[model samples]
Target: MTGKLVVGITGASGAIYAVRFLQHAAQYFDQLLVVMSQHARSVARAELGIEVGDGEQCAQNLLGRPYPNITFLN
Candidate 1:
């Protein structure tokens, strides 16, 4: 209940779901390690109109805010 969580985002059709899940998960988890696929960025842009960048910016782009507990993996 009070630990880390790993979330993976792929180039699937439902990016909004991932975004929403991450937002809620951040509130409960101590740390969030996010692994995003290479095509996920393109899918995010196409579906959610978000420009996902590298490193920390990627998190902000997806979540629309900065979450200190969330870390994006390369």
Candidate 2:
């Protein structure tokens, strides 16, 4: 079977959930896409001490390395 997973990270108190979900999804999904809202970027900076820019590059920094079917949408 083939599948895709779409995860949206919002600006809230549960940012870790998104990260954990991404890690888990990376293992199972054929295509994993994570989209972070602008507010979520702010939240990430505040909570994770990571600065997210306005493009895919910032997401790349956060995600680290590259997975074949993983995509980060800023």
Candidate 3:
């Protein structure tokens, strides 16, 4: 898939939505860049118990592996 995206996740307590979107879209998107804001981290920690201090790791866990198709920006 070829598209433009500016996905943003705030401190609303739902990282799964964004993570799931990336995993699902990775199947078709040629280039996927993820920009995870700082507030989202706390949300993940409070809601998901994933206090890793890195979006890449959380993303990998969500996708079940490392994918080169996505770029993670903390």
Candidate 4:
């Protein structure tokens, strides 16, 4: 409850679910380590109409904001 959490997301149909989970999880965890697959961006764009960018902008693009406690793993 007071530690880090690692979340892995693939090229699934329901990308919104992952996004929602991360949003809620961020409140409970100290840090969030997100690992997204190559095709995850495409799925997100198709399903949620969100552009999951690269590098430091990935989280921002996915969550639609900046979260200091979130980190993307490559």
Off by over 4 Å in 1: none
lDDT (CA) for every model shown?
Answer: 0.89, 0.72, 0.69, 0.88
The candidate that wins on TM-score is: 1
lDDT per residue for candidate 4 within 9-68, as digits (tens), equals 999789989988988898899999999997887899999888887788887899988877
Instruction: Rank candidates by TM-score, best first.
Output: 1, 4, 2, 3
Instruction: In model 3, state the lDDT of residue 70.
Output: 77
Q: Stretches of candidate 2 above 4 Å error?
A: 54-59
RMSD of model 2 against the true structure: 2.2
Please write out the lDDT profile of model 2 over residues 10-60, one tens digit for every residue. 888776677667777788889977788888888887888777675456545
Range of the 10 consecutive residues with the lowest summed lDDT in candidate 4: 51-60
TM-score of each: 0.93, 0.77, 0.72, 0.91
Pairs that collide in candidate 3 are 1-28
Tell me the lDDT of model 4 at 49: 88
Q: How far off is residue 42 in model 1, in Å?
A: 0.9
lDDT of 3 by residue, 1-74 (tens): 78755556666767778767878888888878777677877777677667635556655654568877776766
Model 4 TM-score (2 dp): 0.91
- Model 1 poorest 10 in a row by lDDT: 52-61
Which of the predicted structures, 2 or 4, would earn the higher TM-score when compared with the native? 4
Rank ordering of all candidates by lDDT, starting from the highest = 1, 4, 2, 3
Clashes of 2: 0
Candidate 4: segments with Cα more than 4 A from true spot: none
Query: Where is model 2 poorest over a 10-residue stretch in terms of lDDT?
Result: 54-63
Q: At residue 2, give the lDDT of candidate 2.
A: 62
